[model samples]
Target chain A: MVLYLIGLGLADEQDITLKGLRAVQSCSKVYLESYTSILLVDDFKARMEALYGQPVTLAHRETVELEADEILRGAHEGNVAFLVVGDPLSATTHSDLILRARHYQAPGAEAPTPVPVKIIHNASITTALGSSGLAGYNFGQTVSIPFWTDDWRPDSWLARIGENMGLGLHTLCLSDIKVREQSIEDMSRGVLRYQPPRYMLLPQLISQLLAAAREHQVDFLDPERTLAVALCRMGAEESATRRGELVRAGTLAEMLACTEPDEAQRRQDEQDDEAFEEANPTVSEKEMDARREARRVQRAIDFWGEPLHSLV
Target chain B: MVLYLIGLGLADEQDITLKGLRAVQSCSKVYLESYTSILLVDDFKARMEALYGQPVTLAHRETVELEADEILRGAHEGNVAFLVVGDPLSATTHSDLILRARHYQAPGAEAPTPVPVKIIHNASITTALGSSGLAGYNFGQTVSIPFWTDDWRPDSWLARIGENMGLGLHTLCLSDIKVREQSIEDMSRGVLRYQPPRYMLLPQLISQLLAAAREHQVDFLDPERTLAVALCRMGAEESATRRGELVRAGTLAEMLACTEPDEAQRRQDEQDDEAFEEANPTVSEKEMDARREARRVQRAIDFWGEPLHSLV
Candidate 1:
């Protein structure tokens, strides 16, 4: 039985290639690596299930990292396929799986074992970033922007971006994604509580970048003079402005600022436990207005007439 | 009617996605952008034709650059698909086509008009280079090595690699390809004679690199110490190597040196403009022996190999 590692490209399930879909359809077991990146679309699981005509077991971080033996055992029984976003093996975990699958032996056997493994390549954000009309070759090392905690904030990635800038090359920044994480207290309480999934928004990223620039004395970036393109849901139906003026940075900052609790809300925090109504994850009026105003400005710059994309 | 810019991925026709194939099947015109890169498989046109179930026209630089108006004109009639190897818009010409296709109008039009354009992203070398187990973000600006001319030899790309090395990053050096090139004399004579297609081999690349290191005083690339990976035919069925040692530099130089004219051959060249056997492109015995020895060494080093490929 062959072990197939397939890439489902960017966007929805339809992004899977004819070659990849064939592999998936023929597999006895299909798994989707879901913790790294997101399709950012509704009904993603249902849509994928409908297209594959098979139930896909969504593999979270712990499952992917710790349950390889079980996955390989399934492959031992019949052909098993793992679906990854972007290219099949960009993540080291996937590559390690491929390498491990090659040497996997039956549970109680001692003889050497080999199951043929194949990989299907697809468009990754590394390549999809080309849609921004920037030369791929000009990009230096990419960086990630994680949500900052109160005490620890690292600016190491910014240094690399500055180095790339020094050489007149572009940087393809990968936004940080947090899926199935737990708050420190939640983890210690043994309650199995999970934090809400979070994807770093562009505004938060820009704010962190601005802070890094100021702290690191990275002269390349000045809020008023520096130009940067904040991309989200690239190559999808709805894409952000291909090019941008730094003015959007102001709007984005305001929008993010508006997401913060007001003085009244902060004062009320000590009075009661969170209520269902207060816990609703909806934007405030001012934040909504800020977002609308930002998009309103972006609408003027989207010359490509791409499909509508919400800048989340 | 929409103008679709589809990426054919790497390798052969089978690499085309289901989405791309459906788009091409629905198109009235399909043009393969052949000048930028190659599928590298034999009988590529026939293979693509058999797969697409429609005629595919191979587009050269002259046709793509000079007769773009004619292509956009076809988009006016019905859906037209322009097929590109790797991602569609990585090359400026292809991107220009997308932008131009947007503004194209019917033949005797007066005011500005808009034509729909959709880009289908696929795996390009920029992303496929990840097969080497190197981080995509760690890659600095990529550079292409062109066939050298006697009067001009540019080492600008080497400097970029040096800068990347300074930042502890990797460099993806793309080898140059020459398809349907013309000699200077042929151009002046207005003759349509074409030169044979040339794909740069590793030996040639190393020769140039060594020269560049010395001439440009590149301190980073020490022939004895600096290691590099030689990759070829990425994302293909018969990928040469997931990665190969640049340590083959010594063997390649030796093998290339063995191909030089011997004393007898050099002496005979003075007496005749050309000889029947002298015009042969076959390798000399010494060159063959050196090649075998190199292969022997490579056999020990090629851990992730499927097939033998020229280094350049």
Candidate 2:
């Protein structure tokens, strides 16, 4: 049995290569490794279904980190493909998995430990960010900002960004996302409190950065002098937006106003669109008609003030 | 008049996006920026013809750095596009041009002053190297090697790589490329010592790396244990190879054995085969030709034998 690892790149479903598409088609079971990063567009499932005529099982962070053996259990019988957003091995977790696979190869194991593993490469955000005209080599340590807490807001990221700027290097700040997890309230009460997933928007990120900078006394980075880029709807069909420029309150406010609610709605609309597109045409007509009612909300979000978030 | 800055990714013609292609199509004059990097598969003329149905004017280092006004002159009359290998702004030199355009605007010139420059982004090798299971954040300072040198061959890149390893980070070593320039002999004696543009193979790079390590007295990295990935023909339609493994002389030798002379020729043959299939009336082509040609020369160089290079 062959273990095929494929990189789905940063953008929409089509960002995958012809080679990767073929591997997914022939695989007995395909698992989408749903951590490290999320694809801006949610039509990935529909696109994969359209191209390969197969349902893809999503392997979230828990499944990959904990239940990896279960994910690879049936690989000995036929082809098993694991799809990862961006390049397969960009994240340390995936690399650890590859090492585990190597260790699991036994003399008489059904899957014969030496399973042929092939990686199909695609575009990663690290390289894609170069569009801002920043030299790739001049980039310093990258940091992520988790959803802030009133008592536990960390300002360590400011130090890192300061260090990078000191060396004349640019800092790539990745926003955090909370997905498929219980709320803080639920965890404190020992009860299951399932909350909706949230993608951090540019406004919140900027505000946090500002707050952190102020608290850390990072006087060098003023909003007007320091250049920052916010990318929204990256690698999507309607992928429109901003480039690197000096950070301004007006720009951040504008980005927030457009992205805050619309992002969630866009995700829902994309999911419904994929489902509608995948269903039998005759039966899905009514559903498609019903889905059209949500287009107004989508349009409202699309026409919002500044296109700051769309900047690559 | 607008300055349309387009990124031609890493490899061949098809790597350019539909928007970039359109920008190139509408522009009367297009210049390919050549100093920053070299494309593996497509030349300026060939890519321009294939993507935009026009011939591209090649702007070498001197042409761009010295004769910038000539390239910008057309922007005042009509749309002008500067085609860069990666993203338009990835290099500081292009950004400097943009700043110059802003200066022109400040003078209140009647000309367009290249305002409202459009940037088209594409994948770069910086993040492409992350496919080796190396974390983007884990990479330290990146350095490049030049082709020609005097008696003193600089080995500072070795120190940088060692520092990265000390921090448990991977090093991205950009190999040297010498393209489209008259040699020293040509300038001094008026005899063109035009050598074929050379791309450092993986074996050569590894050899140098080993020698540098010995000189620096660093034994932290074991060629067999150190993970190295060699990527060749990135962002191209034809065979793009990404091989990851421990480095050794035998491995490097094997990789070199597979390198091909002409990638364009192979792609042309494949296209021809596809055209033949479409035109043929009788025979049913059941087999999908998915055989990826081997261009493993870079890999061979990466894994050169123990005591890789003798320090002269």
Candidate 3:
């Protein structure tokens, strides 16, 4: 049995490679890995359906974990393609699945596992950072900042950024996202609670970073000296914007102060969040925290300066 | 005069979004940032010309550093666009450029620096990793391992990876790419030493990691217990493959064993390098050493487990 894994790059469904498209066409069944990251738009299923003239099954996190054997059951009978968002093997879960398939295929074989698993590579954020004109080699560390509670907020990202600064290497801070669900009331009742599924923004991130910097007394950052770029709506045509700027006291304060929810925009955003929450009630609190942080960061940046960071 | 900054996702001129495409089309001039990362295929100028139906200026590292005023000179005169791979502002260089533009625009409000800068986002590797089925949040710190040298091999990557592992987070290791350079020997003789440019491969990275693990006694990696994924030929339709298996003693040993080079492939690779070296000969010896170490690692992996990494 042959297994074909395909990556759907950022943006819409069409970001997939021609090779991946063909694999999807030829495969008897297709499964889209849903959960890790998401396309800016949710019409990927419709787009792929139109492009491939076939239906695709959505593979949620749980399905991928429990239905591995089922997913591959028909691979031996025909061809099966697993559709991923970016590069197929970039994540360990996919790798684990591939390993599982190999194990199943070679149950009792003395020779190495013989099933052929093919991967269709797509652009990943790692490679995408190169677009920023940053020396790929000069990047110190990539860190993700999750949503934190007043009591349990973690300061790991600060250490990471500090380390990067120490080495004069840049840091790629991946904003967080919340895909699952948690009740706001329940969260509020606890020491820390998430309101809804959210994508972290730049403002929230800056606030956290500033607080951490103060707590640690790491003068590694001078709001004016430390530069930051905030990106939102990645992968879509209207992929929102990327703003770069110095995170200084005035700028940071302005960003945080501007978080007065835009009545109209906030309404729309909340509606979108509600829809998502309704559809996926089991979204974890951790994911929500990450998304919130991402949104906060984005908001902060937008408020501090226009989408583009001010050059000295 | 707003500057529209857009990220062209991956390969193919059409990889741009409708909005981004329109922004480029409307702009009187477009600058393509070419140094940070490159597309798997498609020449920059050719692709931009075909897509925008206009001449596209190339912005190499030097142009970005020396010609900032020139690049932003006509922003107020007409629409101008800066083309970046992946997403704009992903790198600090672009951010700095944007900041500079903003500064000029902020002064004396004579049409606000003539050009208003706008950033158009696209699918970046950061968000794209979600497609890999790896929890984006699960990833801890990312580090780049440059081509090392016998005289000064850096084991920083080992420390970074170890820290990530200690936190049970995955580490994304970016390999090095020598874009422009001369031969090492020529430089020694006061002649321009031009060596072919190169990109680090999976095998080289693995070897170095193995060496570092062994040397540092990083107990986190069991060779067999350590899980690693290599991506080759990223963003190409036929370029992605993944190799994953238990890192066993036999596998490591097999990887370290020698194998004959495919002369034809080697020659072709060298030819590509020669062309790049001819144009730019000031290659760093440190980079070369890192590349060599990476190559050795690649050889081991290729010989050992049939190259479990992927090329896209």
Please report the candidate that would top DockQ against the real structure: 1
* Model 2 CAPRI rating: incorrect
| lDDT per residue (tens digit) for residues A127-199 in model 2 | 5665555566677667777768667787777776776666566677777767777877888999966677665
Better of 1 and 2 by lDDT: 1
Model 2: per-residue Cα lDDT at residue B61: 79
CA lDDT for candidate 3: 0.63
Candidate 2 lDDT, B120-216, residue by residue in tens: 5555666456545556666666767554255667887676666556655566677776677676777899885666665665556655676676777
| Residue range with the least summed lDDT across 10 consecutive positions in model 2 chain B | B303-312
How far off is model 1, as Cα RMSD? Answer: 7.7
Per-model C-alpha RMSD: 7.7, 15.7, 11.4
* Candidate number with the higher lDDT (1 or 3): 1
**Which is better, 2 or 3, measured by lDDT?**
3
A240, model 1: CA deviation in Å? 18
Model 3, C-alpha of A210: deviation from truth (Å): 10
- How far residue B287's Cα lies from its native spot in candidate 3, in Å, is 22
Arranged by TM-score with the best first, the candidates are 1, 2, 3
In candidate 1, stretches whose alpha carbon ends up further than 4 angstroms from where it belongs are A238-312, B238-312
Each prediction's whole-model lDDT (CA): 0.71, 0.62, 0.63
Chain B TM-score of all predictions, in order? 0.78, 0.70, 0.71
Interface RMSD of 3: 6.2
Deviation of model 2 at B291, angstroms: 38
